[model samples]
Structures are given as C-alpha cells and as structure tokens.
Target: MLPTLRSLMRQRELALHLLTPEDALPAGALDAAIEWVHSSDLDDPTPFLSAGQVLLSTGTQFEAAPGAESVFAYVQRLRDVGVAGLGFGTEVVRAGTPDALLDACLQIGLPLFEVPYRTPFIAVARAASDMAAEERFARRSWSLGAQRAIAIAALRPDGLSASLEELSRQLGHWVALFNANGALDRVFPAGALAASQPAGPAAAAGADGLVDTVRREATRLLRRGQRASSTITAGGETLTLQTLGRREQLRGVLALGGSSELDQAGNEVVTAVIALAGLALEQNHSLDRARGQIRAAVLRALRHGDLALATSVSDGLWGELPAEPVRCAVVETRGGQLDAVTEHLEALVVEHPGRLFFAVDDGRLVLCLGEDGLPLLTELCSAFALRAGLSEPGAYSDLDRAMAQAEQALARAGDAVGVSEFGEIARDGVLSYLTTTDAGAIGRSVLQPLSEHDAAQHSELLRTLRLWLEQNGQLDATAQLLGVHRHTVRARIAQIEKLLGRDLSGFQERAELWAALLVAAE
Candidate 1:
C-alpha cells in the first residue's frame, strides 16, 4: 500500500500523541525540526509548503472557545483559514497550550498531530522531507506497477469493468467510465473507495458530470472513440481524468483521494492511463459494433418478417443506430460555441438518461430515447437552457423548433431565455398553433403587416385580430381569450377582413389569416 499519514508518522519516529484537552504540547513544538509553520489565518498556506514540506503550528491562530456562544463562529473561522495544525510553540503564543484549542481541533475534525519540544523542528522537517521522498519513490514504483498492470489488463479475457477494477486497485484509486453524455456507466475502485463514493447508481450527477467533461474533450483529441482523456473537478474532488477512442470509447475519470495537489508527474501517469483506456475502449467498441451489427441484421430480417426484436437501441457509441428513435434538437450558439452546448447536454444526462444525447454538426443538439415521460424532453430542454445560463427556455424541441423558439424567447429572456425551462412557457396562443404548421412563408407574409405597424404604433387592431384568429374564429372563445365581449370579436373580425380585403371563412383563407396573425404576435 502507498504510504499514508499513519505509516509516515511511524517512519518519522515522531512521538504519537493523541490531541485532546488533557494533552500537553510535547517539547518538540518549538524545535527547528518542524519544516514549516501554518498560520491557518484565512485562505490557504499550501503555497508556502512547496512539495514534501511538513507543516507545524499552534491551533490558536485557527480557533477559539468551544461553547455554544462561540462554537460555530470559532470553528468556522479556523476552517476558513485552512491551517495544517496548531502547535503551541511553548512561550511564543499561549503559555503551554489551551485545552480549548485541542477541543476545538477535535470538534473541527481537522487532522491534529502533536509535536514535542524535545524533538528538534529541523529533525521533524527532515523527517517530513524524507517521508515525502520515500513516498515519491513508492509512487514511482506503484506507477511502474500500474504500468505493468495495464499491460496485463490489456491481455485480460474478462469484461471491461473487471479489467478496470483490477487496474484501479493497482493504482489505488477509483476509476469511472462516463458516456458522451456524462452519465456514469461503470465504476471500479480500490478497497473502500467504492463504499466511500455513492457508486451504486442512485442517480450519478456530480461524478457523471466530471467524467462527461473529460470524456468529451478526450473524444475531440482522439476521434476514434478509442482514444480520449480529460481531467475535471466534480463533487469537491480532484479527478485526474482521461478518455478512450471512438470505436470502443470510454469516458473514464480516475481520482485518488489522498492528495489534492496535481503535478506534471501525475499528469503523465494520467495520460498513460488514458492511453490504456483508449486501447480498451477501442476494443470494446469494435466488439460492440460487431455485436450490434449481428443484432441489427437479425432484427432487420425479423422486422421484415415476424420475430419481435426490441425497438429500442442500446446507448452504444454508434449513434443509436438502426433501432432507437433519435431526434435532433438543434441548439444555436453564439458564433461557434458548440462545446458549451455539449457540456450542457452532458450535465443533463447524468441525472436523466432520457435520451441518447449528442451534439451534431456543431449548431444542433440530438437526443435518443427518453426513459421517462415525453414531457421529460421538455424539462430537459429547460434544464439545458438554464445551465447554459439562459433565463427563460423557449420552444427548444428540435433544431428547427428549439432554434426558432429560442430565437423568439431569447428576445424577452435575453440570456435568461435558455436558462428557463422553456417547456412550461404556457404556450397556448398563436405561437403554439404555428408550431404544428410548417406554414413558414405564408405565415411570415401574414405577419408583415404587424411588423410594418410596430415601426409606427403599438396598435390593438393587429393584437385583437391575432387573438380572434387563435381562438379559431369562435366569437365566444375569441372574446374570452381577448378579455372582450363576443360582439367585440365579431367587430374585430369584420375590421380585419375588410382591412385585408378578403373573407376569412374558408379553410385556405383561415390558414393564411392565422399564419398572418402568428407572424404579428411573434
């Protein structure tokens, strides 16, 4: 096992004294053996530690009394400062050491290590340095062992999950595989890592998002779906991430819990791990493709004749091919910021695997099938828009639908448009009616009059006409919709027909007028 706080302490021969109110600061508190002193004075002191430097200090700079009157405030202050540990340093600060300080340290739950005045601070510092060196050596050896393990994993006849679990154990970390959408599919951790994490599929959100971001970038680097990797933070964890290739792509993110610091060496190891993941993913994809091909062939044959193969497609990397019902919802970006849109989709998928989601051709978003209700698509659109920092979600359905809706909603929502859940916009007017009609050109022509009018006055005539038309020529309904009497509806209709020089009773004529009314509303 890699060296830990317990092991390092043992090797250093540092007096093992449990911190308690009864405990006194051992004679080593002021010794130069201690490599560094931590003030725990607001913000962080990690910058001062360089690398491998042991830090010592008294807890006074961090906490105060631990009673109800001052407990939370005292602990909060110390946590905010982020001290290594408090060392009384003999006569420097507090006479010997305050019981309150030790109590506070225990209550705050920060790691507290005792220092003895007899032990020279320099010797302590040296011990820390030596321990760090030893750790580095051990890390290198483990990395080499991991390299060898990867080689062995490459040859494993087991499934991807099994091989990866062993690899994670060798690396002493938790490894997770994310899909293009950022959903957690597989997780392999060493020993207690899985138990420490919420890995049993209770809605993978935080970890899923981290893996998704990394996988997406990795995919861009190695399009083969078999070569990709990225690193990101999610759930307050430092994740050294990477991805696999396009064929058998694995959007995997690896995280080791001991240290938050990331070095060039760690990055190299992460890169190598990613390279190995790429190989595995490529192999997985090829195997999947072969399996998919055979299944598809049989399904197609069955479809033509009789056997019933499930209509739904697997969430495989082959684009929900030949089976699943995939719809392309185009999300428009500013100039060329498609990657942001992809990120939004990824954020959504970790919670709801509603669809096989992907960004297509940069300007558009595509979704596979939804596991929940059809309305989830609407909610998802709302969420994606909101996360993208948009305010009100507009009619974001397909590329044509969402783009058009977003364009219109964006005007009012401004940046808030995408942020709002557009599916709940209460769209029950001309806009809603127009959604069903592909009446693109004629509708615009009908609304041109209103555009000409908006340039002049914000008149009620056009508005009344739009309301009446949306009510489907029903005088009573139009009256209700427009908050006017039934007679007002008839009168407005007469004026509108006379103004346009056409009777609006026939279906064709009604369609044209309705289109025009919609144009004006927009």
Candidate 2:
C-alpha cells in the first residue's frame, strides 16, 4: 500500500504540515493514496504529472503576490489532473505560505501541505519511492507464495477441484468450475454471500446470480467452439471466465468472482491457477484415453470368448462385469459433440461403478449394460442427440454375434438421431450373413481403394460414401447429414463409383457397396 497524504504528514523528520483544515477535508481526502511525489516550478506542470501524484514546488511560477483568480486557476488545473495533494516549499521563493494559494486550495477541496526548507523535495520523492518499492516487493512475494500453494493443491487426489479451492482461498473470493456442457462441477465457498460478514470482495454480490451468469457464459463459449475468455459484472462484482483445454477438445470453464478488480500480482496468481487447471485437465484426458483402451481390450476379450481375461482385467478397476444376458449398444454422433458426451458418460460410470461399461471403438462409443440399464441407454441417446443401435440380451459368449446385431440395428437407423433395435429389423437374409468374418474380409478388399485414398490424403471420402449409402443414394439427405453441399456429395459419390469401377445407379452395385460398409463396420 502506498502512503496516503495523512500518513506522509506523520513522518516527523520531514516536518510536513497539513494546511487544509481537518474539518474541511473532502471525502476520502485524508486517505487519498499518493502514487508519487514530484517537484516542478513550471506554471503548467499538469501535462507532466499523472493522476494520484503529489506535486511539490517553490512557488517560482507565481507572481510576487498572485491574485485570488490566478491561485484558483492553478489549484483547479492540479485537481483536474487528479493530483492527490499539493506541497508548497515555504521560505524558499517566499517568506511564508501565500494566503491566496491557501484560500484557493481550501475552496476547491484540494489537499495542501507545507514543506519546510530543511526538507529537500528529493527527500519526499525518495520516501514515496521507497514505500512503492516495498509494496511491489511484498506483492511479488505474495504472488509467488500463492502460486506455490495452488501448485501444491493441484497434487491432491482431487487435484483439479482442489486447486480451484486454493485459488479462492488465496484470493479471498468465490471460484467455480463448469464442465464442457456448461454444468457446474464445483464451487468454492459454496453458499450465499453476505455483505455484513465480508466473505471476500464478492461476498457483497449474491452468489446465486454469480453462478448463473458464469454458467451462461460458459455455454456461450462452448457453443462458439473456440478458446477464449470473457469478463462480466454480476450483482455488482467482476467475474472472469476462461475456457480450459484445446479449442477442438474443450474440457471445461473456470470462473473467478470478486467485488474488486485484481491487481497485477493477483492476476499473476490467477494465471498460474488457470495453467495448472489446464494441465490437470489434459492429464485426465490422457488417463481417459488409457482407460478407454483398457475397456476396448476387455470388450475384445468378451467377443473372442475369453471371459476369464475380460473379468480379470475389469474386476478391480471398474467393478464386476455385467452378468450374462447383457445387451450391446453402439452409439454414433454427428460430429464435435463426442468429447462432451464422453465426459458425461465418464462421470456416470464413476458415479454408478459397475452398473455399466463403455469403450471407444472405430470412432463409435460402445456400451455393454445389463438389461435393466436399457433405459439409461435411451436417456443417453436422447440427451446427447445421438444415433444408437441395440442388440437383444445374450450370454457373454455371444457378444461377437450381438455386436453384429447392434451394427445391423444402427444401420437400420440410417441418418436419423434415435435408437434402432436389432430384433425389430432382424431377418434371415443377405445383410445378416454379410456381417460374418469371411464376408468382412471380402468387404475390406472391395473398399480397399477408397480406404487407401482416405489414409494417404487424410480425406473423408470413406465417410461420405458411408453416409451416402446410409441415405440410400439421396444426395440432398447425405449432404445435409454431412453438413456439406449437395454437389460435393454427388462428386464424392461419382468418385466412389469410379474407384469401385461399378455403376452406383444400379441396385446390385448399391446393395454390394452397402453390404461392404456393414461388414467393415462390424
């Protein structure tokens, strides 16, 4: 904290005297913070002075006996530039303090103090400079200490949430975190704020509105699908909202709220917290990827009839596997919503333990839940606007066949966002037969050219062809589902036909291509 004018006058060695009457002082004048002390003899020194500075002079710029109007003008100019106070050097260019100058300061509410000749202007400047330097040092030390505390908090078991709590504690303000779906994940000092109690600067502002506003901003940022930050005032307090993780894979949002604006030191502490939060989120993402791989491995074991291996791997980590007579469901999203949906599912899996199991396979989210958990599957699909294909309940040994059933059901859903059941569309037909191992190998060979082109050029030709087939060769529907122009869909289909050396317009060729797609999917 810088020394105010009242504090400066208390320095006995300087022999400073307050000329402004104690009773006549303006509001906050006694505690007016002085940023620095400067000396000048120029008539108009306001141009060189900044706000909150205390200007000292020897009265050299004034006439021998300046008039009241001239004195008032000088005082007004200083006040206009936000000078904290004026210090006149007595007995230097004059025998004593000028009456006109004193009168003008008193009338204009500008603080006026006297500087004795024994005290050089440099002495006042040095004192103010030393105080500012000490303040800077103290702030820097506090920032470093706060950053260390936040870092330590991030190492806790609940690292991400713990770091946020520490930041709120260090700043003496409220902090909240929101997941990518704009759902409130955690809040520090969780409750209503009371002004009389003084629970940090933002305590005066109600926490209810604070949280609502933060979540609203979080949603807006997520919808924008970009990495950015915004600051807003909620219930008379300032709140900062920042996006976490990369732009394409946003993890969540972090919000801090307080009545007063953060100083540079406080900002540095917040910046460190943001960085640590991001690191924790990225670490969790990596961990989630590893977990997904393990889940996928478990699923593969079940498909290969290795129940023992699957049970051993999943037993302690995710609870026991679902009992026999389990149903399989494969989910697919349009695009860009996969990360948010995956996060939601992860939370559910943690909350429910072994109630269900899930994994990411071939760009689709796959799940195996007990027959009783079927309602949850529907809820998930509806909530996330996803398309899902479900198979009838079967023993663990029949998982491979069940997967084909689910894939067939999903194919029946076409380009719509809803659930499709294998039992509803099952038939003893070519489609069902094509989903076998021998058929899959032939299908892969048939689409090998398109697959190679996609892998080498990083193109979406394969995806386009799949969607076109799903839409039953309808260009408009395929374009709408892919979020592209109809002409582009037509061109891709034309290119597919050329690569396959088959007329896509023919029913036999279309059926063959569709079967190949189903085989590859299984």
Candidate 3:
C-alpha cells in the first residue's frame, strides 16, 4: 500500500507529528494512498496538484500573517482538489503552525501534519515516491499471479464458473455473469450476493432497483453492438458493469460490486477474464448454430417420412425422443423484425436444453417442443407480439400432418386470437383444406346475388344476413348486434331469402349458408 497520512506520521525517521486528531481526519484518510508529495509556496497550488497527494508548504505566503479568510480559502481549495493531507513545515517563516491554518484544516476535515525542521520536504517526497513505486510493483506481481490462477481455472472442468470464483476471491468482491439476453449464467460467491438486494435495511431500497436498471441498460448496449462500461453507487458500494466481447460483437456482461474502485492491476485481471469469457461465448454460439442446423435437417427428414434418417440425425443432439408425442408450433412476428424473436426462442432452447427442437424456415420460426411446453410458447408469443399456430401432439411420423395443421392455424390467426391450436380449427378443416378448390367457387355462387345488390345499393344486406344466421335467425339478437330495430333485420332477411330463392326454415340450408359465409370470410 502507498504511504498514508497515518503511516507517514508514524515513521520515526521522518519525525512527522500529527497535528489533526483522529476524529478530525477525513473519512478513509488512514487508507488513502499517497500518489506523491508536492511542496509548494504558491498562493493557490491546487491548479498544479492532483488527488491522492500529500501537499507540503513552508507557510512562506503567510509571512505577513494572512488572515483567517485566506487560510480557509487555501485549505478549502486543497480539499476540493482531493489532496490526501496537508503538511506544514514549521520553524521557517513562523515559529509554530498558524492558528488560522490549523483551524481551517480542522473545519474541512483535511488531515494536517507538522513537518520538523530536521526533516526536509524533499525527504518526505522521496519516501512517498519510493513507497508508491513499491506498492505498484507488488500489485503488479499479485495481478500477474491472479491472471495465471484464472487461466488455470478456465481449464478446469467447471471452466468459466471456476475462473469467476477465482476472480471473486482475488478481488474480495462479488462477480456475476450475464448472457446476451440478460439472463444470469453464473455468479461468484454463489448465492451470497443478490444483485437485486443488499445485505441489510441500512442500504437504500433504490440500490436494489439498480440491478434491473443496469441490466436493461447493459442489454441495450449489447443489442446496439457496442462495448460499454457503467458505474453506479448502490448500497454504499460502487457497482461496475463491463461488456465482454470484441468490437461490435458483444457476447456477455460482467458485474462487480466493491467498496472501492478497481486499481490498475485489478483492471488487467478483469480484462483477461473478459477475453476468456468472450471466447467461450463465441464457441457456445457456434455449437448452438451447428446443433440448430442438425435439428433442421432432422425436422426435414421427419417431414418426408424418413424416420430412420431423422432419428439418426437427432441421436447425438438429443438423448431420447419425447415418448408422449410432441406439439409443432409455428411462430411469426405480426409486423416486427423476426431476428430478436428468433434469438429469444433460441435462448429458451438453451434454457430447456433437449426439450425443444427449433429451426428458422424462411422468415418463420418452427419449433417442435414437448406437449407441456405449450405454456412457454404462449408466453413467448405474448412477449414478442407474435402470432403462433400450434398443432396437436402427434407421433414423429405425423410431423408432415402436424406442420400442415400448424400452417393452417397460423393462417387463421387474427385480432381475436393471436395463437391458435390445430384442434380448435379441425372442425372446419374440410372447408379450410378446399380453400383453393371448390370452396371459393361455392362461396362466390352462394353469396353473389347479395354482394352485387349491396354493392349497387350501398346496403349491408349480406352483413345482416350473416349476423342473422350467426344469431340462429333470432331477429331480436341480430337486430341488437347490428344496433338496428327488429323490423329492419326482418326486412333484410326477407330480401336475402327472395334473392337466393332458398327457404330460411331448413337446417341444411342454414348449414350451407354458414359454410359459404365461412369461405367468403376467409
């Protein structure tokens, strides 16, 4: 450690005497490292001074007994510059320390020391400089050892977790790793530190809120493809967040909490850890991409009824196929870009491991997850403002049918239903399947008269008839739905019956009209 005010005062060789009482010393004065000792007689030496320095002066500027005002201004300036302490050389311009200067130092809580005539300011400067150099060298050695330890830990079975544990131990601080999606991958010290909570109520509640704020900001930075570092004081601790990656390819984030800022040596170790983490993340991404490709191939094989080839392709990727049948889900964004949604789904796959097989076909995401995974899929859909179609749980050999069902369901998605299941629409599967066949022709012929009449007269007769049919020919219900009187609804139905020359009393006619209406709506 660099020499501090307390240490310098205790050095018998220098014979420095502490004029400031222990209580008068500024907070952290005992541990505040002195970068160097600066001796100056200038009226305002703060401009040439920097923080963490012990400023020595001979009081020559106060030879004329500069009043309390000048003394207070000078001391305040030194404090503003963050000088570690102020040293006065006595027995030169005045016999002892000035009462005004001492009072000023006391008022500002700046540590004050009296330098004896026998001990020159140059001697003090040399001693501080030497100690600082030694401390730097020691810190460098310690940091190098830590780097080696971390490297070895990275090679262990636990890999990144081991390395992070070693780092946490070296820093005496908590460390956490967050993936690109802002999900925590691992943390050092395990559960000892909650990023969202402090250890006691003495800590501010706002500090706990910082965890989510910092995480969101970090995630935004990563999404923008930028390297970022953020520092925030929370729970009286300095929390630092660093992005891990090269250039614009951000792969992860490292969060550290400590009482003090990291020194140069600590920064070096963190840099090494960041590099290692980036490489690991890249490797994992490559492996995931490869696995996705294999899964895609397997899905294609299954679609073609090539069960043997599909099983062979998936053998190494998944331990066993789901015995209880699987549901196929087709998801697509309504208007947003699909990339973010795809990445989120991929993260879900990572979380669930072998429970899901996913592939991006064209601009849509295709997922074959276990039957119980429907809730997760639903949540993803809601989160991403996505439209999803789910097929019924079926055998591996039935993937082609399931995929067709999923596609049909997806086509049927609308404002009322953002996610539709195949079973929910299977009753109308015949009409849906004949979309390009006789359904279109039948719909046009059945509703052509009403459509032409409405177009010419600017009337809503067809709409009224559809509402009437939907309401089970209940004039009151149809009239209420249309916000019209029952007489108006009866008149529209009478016109519809006359135009189609079909009786409104038969179940078969009503069913046929309903089918035609369904085809027309599609």
* Tens digits of per-residue lDDT for model 1, 214-250: 4554445444445433455644555655545444534
Candidate 2 lDDT, tens digit per residue, 375-456?
7788888888899999999988888788888988887777778788888775546676556447888888999999998999
TM-score of 3: 0.76
Rank ordering of all candidates by lDDT, starting from the highest: 2, 3, 1
Better of 1 and 3 by lDDT: 3
Find the candidate with the highest TM-score and give its number: 3
- Superposed on all Cα atoms, model 1 deviates from the true structure by an RMSD in Å of 14.5
In the predicted model 3, the residue pairs found to clash are none
Per-residue alpha-carbon lDDT of model 3 for 1-522, expressed as tens digits?
A: 678877777778999988889777756776788888999999999889999988999999899899899999999999999998989999977788999999998999888889999999998988787777888999999999999999999999758788889999999888888877665566778753454365577345554465566577667666777888888876567778888877676778888877888988998998899888878878877876786677677778877888787766666656444444888888876543454566566667657655767776665678887866777788887776678888999987888788888987887665544678878777766667556345877887899999999999999988998889989999999999999999999888888899999998889998888888887776
Residue 46 miss distance in model 2 (angstroms): 1.2
After superposition, candidate 1 runs with Cα above 4 Å error: 1-158, 176-185, 190-276, 291-433, 436-441, 447-498, 504-515, 518-522
Model 1 residue 431 lDDT score: 56
Q: How high a TM-score does candidate 1 get? A: 0.39
State model 3's lDDT. Answer: 0.80
